[model samples]
Target: MSYISRLGSAFSKSSMFASEFFLDLYMYAHYCGISPFQDRRNKTYYKLIIETHAIEKGLSLANPRMLFGRKKITEIMKAARRYGIGSNDLPILMATGALQDYLALHRSAGLSDPLLDSIDAFLKDRATASAVLGSGGLRHYPDGMPSPSPEKAALLTSRFSCRMFSPEPLDAETVKEIVRIAQTAPSQCNRQATKIHFYSNRERIGQLLALQAGSAGFAETVTGLVVVAFDLAAWGGAQQRNQGYVDASLFAMNLMLAAHAMGAASCPLNLAVPHSTERQIKIVGEIPKDQRLVMMIALGRPADGPLKSAASPRRTIDEILTIRDQAVAAA
Candidate 1:
């Protein structure tokens, strides 16, 4: 039996191994800083069975007397061996199953907001990111919940990617702290495969901005640019298959949210600058050649116009959240 199927079977089983195995995988993803749902669309068939089984097992966990036993766990292992481990079902299956207990255990950590904020950045339309610093007040949650803002819904309602920039320049330390905030982004298996490039050169900043803007018309007044990326060497040039890019990207997104929280406007850039700019950056900036540029951010005060930058439109949750016919059985 394949290792994946064994894991799936273990996870899908409505008995002891179900939630416990899920909990293990959840911790692993958390440590790796990967979103459980972020890329599951890439592998859906293997995931379906695990997700369906997890729900059934979760129900059983609630009521031990009915269909909940070691024997059920045995079924899950058997099923997993048959189905495989890297299944798309693993993400949701892990999410909806053991995650509750996992969240319950980590309730004190309050890491959920940053993680949720990162997910929001990926799902929402973003134009750019920034390097602004936050006041001490910004870090404190007025009413501490496992969510963002004084109201739990603040994460959903008020969070947005910042666009536009002022002529002002942020201090190097401020940029350092903003990157420092990103430094906390979880890495896969604690590999910490990420790095940051701080750009203060107005000319270079404008160049990147223009390339991303599709014209020389990018906000010329912008003063800060930060390149978020991952160091391939961190993976030893062999762990490429470990999927570290997703981890770094998610970390960068969280940094963008933290910047917004700190009362600064920013933009996320795709770094499509010409090879010349890339070479200049590599030479002058001393950037590692193997690091993959995950994303870039332009940070500064908002220079107001007709509001050239606003939150782009987003899909309804219903669009992003599909209800598989069987997964909806709980509904």
Candidate 2:
């Protein structure tokens, strides 16, 4: 090619690349939750999730401050009242339960405060009233950790996304074991950013699954829901921005395999929503803001009787494999 022609082509390519980059920035600004364009409902819902999680985290602390998170409880009440969030909503219900647990814990210790009265009033208010759906606040683990199960060779090929599940919930021991196996998945620099939030409450599971798009027909049958996420704090620099997803995906695959090995069925649900929706999920799931969601896994004991699943045909080995041999051919 002529020198002038080459120069012109290079310039055109650079201009196109710059334009595309700016377009990406524009889209991100318009849609990201941090931007002003975020939906009002999502913002209100996100606030509730964050406040409730704060209470939960405080309760989980080994040495919690006396009467801590009073402001957070107030914020939760305000958001719930403003948005009309009811007990039927998992996030609100969890917030109420966490507050109740907080009050009970403090009262038992013979500590009394006006903030407790405020929390009590908030709980009794009809506008924000919600039954504390299931056990919330702090999760109590069994005394000892369960040992990991032996690896089954057939699990890889035999396992598929299970759509139908029995009414039985997954046992806590088995769930812990599955997570123990999944924790073995490789991570970037061994940061171990991946975290799983398991939900076994049928009503809460239904509420969570409702936010997901792919669980339409079989959501009712799902007895366990697992939200797989990776901590953003584990990654730094522009090059590592997307690394969280890669690591979390690896962890999620391992988790599914582990479930299958444990004789439980699991189906992965996609979380390809806007930034606003993601924020809402993080809040509702009681996940930390530093974590980014990868996907959700609906799991449980397989239903009895014959079951059907997608064929999910695969490409041929020849189509997928590409053994480049340019050096050999040149030689």
Which candidate should be chosen as best, given lDDT against the real structure? 2
TM-score of 1: 0.48
Tell me each candidate's TM-score: 0.48, 0.54
> TM-score for model 2?
0.54
lDDT of each: 0.51, 0.75
Q: Candidate 1's residue-wise lDDT over 169-238, tens digit each? A: 7777777677777677778788888787778888787655554552223456568877776777666322
Any idea how many clashes model 1 has?
21
Candidate 1, run of 10 with poorest lDDT: 131-140
Q: Candidate 2: where are CA atoms >4 Å away?
A: 1-153, 326-331
lDDT of 2 by residue, 199-240 (tens): 998888877887887676677778999999987878764445
